[model samples]
Target chain A: MTDRAFAVVRAGALTSVQDRGRPGHAHLGVPRSGALDEPARDLANRLVGNPLGAAVLETTLSGCAVRPRCAVTVAVTGAPCRVTVDGRPAAWGAPVRVAAGAVLDVGSAADGVRSYLAFAGGVACEPVLGSRSTDLLSGLGPAPLTHGTVLPLGPVAGPPVYADAVPWQGPPRELVLRAGPGPRTDWFTARALRTLVTAVYRVSPAGNRIGLRTEGPPLERAVDGELPSEGMVLGAVQVPPDGRPVVFLADHPTTGGYPVIAVVKERDLAAAAQAAPGTPLRFVLTERR
Target chain B: MSTMRVLPAGDRALLVELGSGEEAEAFHAELLRRRARGTLPAVREIVPAARTVLLDGLDDPARFAKGLADWEIPALVSGAGSTVELPVRYDGPDLAAVAELWGVPAGEVGRIHARTPFRVAFCGFAPGFGYLTGLAERYAVPRRSTPRTAVPAGAVALAGAYTGVYPRSSPGGWQLIGSTDAVLWDHARVPAALLTPGTRVRFVPEEG
Candidate 1:
């Protein structure tokens, strides 16, 4: 791999490289830690013409500002971040080609909470355990990108430019989600989850890579006894004694003790990942097989 | 009345409940047997818990259900099974604390930890991590009230009915009793994780 540099002009709170994430090791207790906004990440990559699973940047809470070492083309998607290249405004949901040494800045969006940046080729980081995504919870890959960190990019095949949208936009929800039965649904109080799925829940400010705290009707567990620690999965809605359901996300641990009442559908994950604080969500159970 | 039910979880996963822990164990064993014989289709992984099993598979639910219906329950492994010895250094910060809570000698904790071989119960959460069950009764200790922000890799810990080693450094609430140098997960390895369900493990005190 050739060494390159793409300086972070203004690194926001959290900016890290991510790919499709490490999969196929669930038996080993590993979470499939990757891009939080999967669809946005995919769309950005496609716009820049990178492979579907190629590594891209995941900027969380706040946004980021970047400057390529040489002439490079890139795309931005997710969280609707307000973007500008070399002080000239650019649009989200599209790609932009920059001349050599052009500076690109990403600012927080009025709507969502995270943004994805895809290079024409892909963000080339030293892959750890078959993925380039940063597993902050596991400390498995490169640390989050900082202001001075120079990211290396690989060679691209064509000129940088924006592409038209394809036909794959997902469900439209204020807080998008698809639901499924959890591993320990039997532990939940009868109809407790029905209330959860039908009621509107607000995202508590207490949210991070591990899980999202939500405020709604308290979900009661049937068996009061402590559960032996067991395996967990991304999107698992775990209820602790406090009653608020914590939805596990990308950097979740391998196992937990609290009862999990539901799992968010994989396709609905992107919307949840980009949910801003106070966003209200309502889970609609589906007959989808 | 049946106390549990099987439900479709997603496009590629299912949640099967067997009521009690014993029933879950039996069902998991049968599923494992079917998996080994290549009789199960579409299933990518089968994770067993105290009373349920989460089956993740390639995106075909109908085919997976068919495979489940066709599985034949197999006999459990009898007598002494294959055992792999592991060297563990009994110097974790929580070892003495856990021993005192158990009303046992601190040094005796190590001996008890090694007394009986533990079996891999299930795997999930992160890659190459294993949930080991069947710890000796005396060694059982509740998890810490507050989890550590970061538990170093290879740290061996126990909580409730299970004990495990942290595959990578992360936040944890388990009571750490020891550590091991063995690599539980190496991405380059043909099969990354060392422990799979039913694999037996014995911890030998490290000499240093």
Candidate 2:
């Protein structure tokens, strides 16, 4: 009822409210569903003078459009895109003030698969287990934004902070990851490990928030039987019956029946988030102990 | 031999391997006890499974992995964890099939299952679905060769050496023998899942 809210004008492909996400609940089968690009969300918050962990809008592929009910300061980061205020062009990675009822259009991503938008006051939605992130797997938090959806805004804590520039890391053309040893590495054949690091892979269209399914040479296994469902961790490179490695993402299940060949370093996962389907990928496997 | 080993899961987690599910349950208990007593490092989640326990969100997993070999895990703390009694109806399509597998009368399956106490070895497949272990290895049953497209929620099922109630409708290969009315998971509820690892489960037969 209050005027401190915005109405969705264009919901784009997939847009959801996300924060740092509800972690530490994996034992109860909750996935750590946070913004894939944590740094991008942090930068967007900094420009809008919101807390680093404040909830922001994460838009996939093409961006979104919104009309605020009140005057607000906003910023956009992650995957460079054409941002426009009403009919005029606006800054892409910097703060921009918009009048009440003005349409803020976030156009198709120029280079990345996702873009982040932050308001001076973060999106104030009902938090579930200490997060507002929409978990696609568990169906927690608010549902994905639809056209005409009204989202409440929290009270602004401070004025917008203007910086000289916020560096934008372009989306990865060739997604390279630093992989480490696994808990179930012995499940694979000795030659499998060698094939894993040397094989050329591409991001399959089947990739999602749960995992990045790879299309590559199948890793041969020493053990043919399925694992007795074991606890899985973030960044685990789980190989199914088919042998293609799947890199677990934020929304991955806590346990799986597949054997993990290796684990991708946490630092490199941000680039994986923006990798479009068919992006070439290489694994630089670390020494096995 | 009480075999135990630890493997590093990237930089943030360590997977402790045990010889059996019972050992995993005991080790998970030790980890929880240490966590409560402030002896263990501040890790996010310590998840148990069939024969492995994952220590996640640790700052330095290698340091913890090195110390695991020296620690002696105690036996499971009897009567320490909460026990849940589930009232189930012995009317499922797979009841006859499961009864045949056990070489018992169809009607006797419910009574036999209700008498034994099952402990949750771990939870996986979906939210709130706990893999309960108690039946001896001799009772291990093979999963359905072709999984049903939709196993209704609350279906009490068996596979291998474990029994579980489906928390939600999902495609599963387990042999179903009954159904329960209890809600296994509710996001609005505190703790969300009704069955967590280390809990004791007792199935009670509902009057037909």
Candidate 3:
């Protein structure tokens, strides 16, 4: 195959192509879908010498495996995982060169929830709205990666970075998110804010790409019924009728009716993506955004 | 008109609240005009909803929000947007209920709904699906107490003061009144959604 493609050998539990998500389409009810762990995806891209927003594979919990049609340099980041080339151990966070026809395996996460794998020249799938990201919400772009799926690759962009020591922050023992007020703060009781900060919350197993469901104290509503549908931004701490706050993520609906009590800082959300199920989450209410 | 209130949604987004859906639509139209004319500041997304418009990915959310206070928004141009015609068959199960709600004979339901012009107020619930406004407040209807397990694609429905066509098969609560053959969503097409925010629409009745 002269097409420079990588065939999925072991399709993990959930794997999809992602880059900087297709934005500017929220008005059409399109979610801004992209890499959950932005910094880790960027680091993988940097190691493989691809552009900042080049497409890469985002593997959930159990990682995926791929075999390139041509010699390639690849890097795996995000959740710490066991990576192997042709049944031999390979670097997990650093770039490794693999010859054509060799199986590159990315195993299950040791701590985090998602892992990012970037290949040299990036996955060159036909861009939908100028993104390769698979939006689970709108069902846009490519579908989730499956075994035998062959994805084309773009031409190499730049030289790969082989660093001696790259700063790697391990997955948090307890997730801390700094949150600021949302537009519908008045909908919740005064004690709701206190409960939000003081109450213990864990990342629920029901969480998906759309939002992080939290198992915690249900916030008391000051008002009754739902609001007229309003735009939902990333990190929106929306309190549903059930009263549990669900933190909006990359594939969140463009608009929602549930009242949003607060919005976690965008920087803090990258960590939220890697948070494993049952990980303790703390929402620190801050005066300033 | 009440002053447009700009509330903070997050550090990256600001929500501008309008008095009603009509005002929100008008503001969205004006914002589109400014964005097209290169007058609006650099922002990532402009999402319109029931009574608000959210501006996201702003470099300085505070500054952009402060500008809203100093500006005057123009009203939306009536009958201005691109109009799409849909051939609809009024064969829904709730046709009688809707007719009773309108105090009109079952036969008149199709004629009355087909006559009114519609505009897409905002899009939500799903992609390619638009919340369309056309009927007056008196024509508004409540949603079904028990929503359908699956509302088929191209199903024309009504809720509150809005009418919408289901883009694809999904669970929905709107009262189904008719059906359309026109594809509401086609991702392969240039503009995937047949109906978008601010679009004008007219339904033509299909002969039995």
Candidate 4:
């Protein structure tokens, strides 16, 4: 093991390396797969004094544990989670030093579905297309972390940023998405549109990096035949044959055949990433800004 | 020069609705030409699909939409663009079923497929996978009733009015007619996808 490498002690349920995803590749049928909670990932990198685009570990509801080959500064952000070093309690949002060969354990998220962890130096995995983000849909970048996996770390850029306090938002009790009318709003009945905005939906447990599937009143379509396959954008609220709206997330497909009634604002997607299953969801349609 | 509708896909993206896939392709090519000339700014991605082209990551989507409304779409000059030829072995499991559907001998399937030239209409389902159009309306077929659990990479398949090659192993419902060894996607290759929208494609069957 190199001095700047870490071995995974426990990989939890699902853990993958992520950064600012590979954009501008939709034309090649590639998805923009990156950290779902962009702000949290950015904050973790900032706390560790790493570049904003540095690759970090994105853990699912259950967190992970790693043992570095060398002492390093680390910060955990996103969902508030229990942090420990060799069974001793450690800081959650602030930078903390971990001795070489010591285990850094991140516990299950307290309230959210995902968490972000950043090292003093970013994960230096070989990038497939200028990014270390693991794309689940297209199978690009590094694979999800498994137990005993070793990851190389980049050179430390600078000392960690010491701060008295770091602002963090808790998981949304109700995921409210501000949406704008879209490419195929005319395909749905007027009552379906009304139901989309007025009805209450809950996040489906089947939701993953691909989309936030919802369970609610099935939307009725005015048109019968399927629309020709069309390009889909992030945050697109696509309604499939099942009629439930599935909001495209970071790892969403580049094209889809379903009608997209609206697109949620990109800013609100971070909260959507944290919204646990069964969380109420409401869509407020607004004029395109 | 049919009238086009530019709808707001989101705050940063504009979806232009063209009447047909050919129109969408022409519009996409025009946008790429304009982008090459440095006229389009803050344009992140131009994704051309069956009947619409989505322009994403623009600084001002509304302003761009206004410009697109006035932009004239050029005629597509077929045979003037790049073409990728793929060599195939006609030994797919569904070849007999597809031949039965067409009421033709199984051996005639490969010849019929290779005779027609295909145009990449759009790409989706997976990376580097292009939905090619060329088959006549009579050849349009429905997807298999049950999807396969694992379709091998490079499997040449057809569904509806489109034919496509599996970029990688994935579950699919398309009727498999052959297999190819050509690399569809490679990160090391420039323009990773072998088939991009507007590119022409030809399939050549290996002689027994």
Query: iRMS of candidate 1, one decimal?
Result: 3.1
For candidate 1, lDDT tens digit of each residue in B105-166?
Answer: 89887888877668777776556666777775566688799999999999999877678888
lDDT of each: 0.75, 0.89, 0.92, 0.92
Question: Where does the lowest 10-residue lDDT sum fall in candidate 1 chain A?
Answer: A164-173
Error of 3 at A230 (Å): 0.7
Which residue pairs collide in model 2, if any? none
Write down the TM-score of every candidate.
0.86, 0.96, 0.96, 0.98
Q: Candidate 2 local accuracy as lDDT?
A: 0.89
Arrange candidates by TM-score, highest first: which order? 4, 3, 2, 1
Residue runs of model 1 more than 4 Å from their true location after superposition: A1-3, A157-173, A176-178, A287-289, B1-8, B18-37, B66-70, B78-83, B92-104, B124-128, B146-152, B168-171, B186-192
DockQ (C-alpha based) per candidate is 0.45, 0.77, 0.86, 0.86
Local lDDT at A120 for model 1: 82
lDDT of 3 by residue, A186-215 (tens): 888889988999998999999999999999
Q: What is the TM-score of chain A in candidate 3?
A: 0.98
Candidate 3, residues B5-99, lDDT tens digits: the string is 88889888899999988899989998899999999988999999999999998889888877777667777779898999999999998999999
Query: Taking the tens digit of each residue's C-alpha lDDT, what string does model 4 give over B140-187?
Result: 888999999999999999998899999999999999999999999998
What tens digits encode model 2's per-residue C-alpha lDDT throughout B117-194? 898888877889899988877667899999999999999999997999999899899999899999998888888899
Fnat, 2 decimals, each candidate: 0.50, 0.73, 0.89, 0.87
**Window of ten residues with lowest summed lDDT in model 4 chain B:** B65-74
Q: Poorest 10 consecutive residues of model 3 chain A by lDDT? A: A280-289
Q: How high is the lDDT of residue A203 in model 4?
A: 98
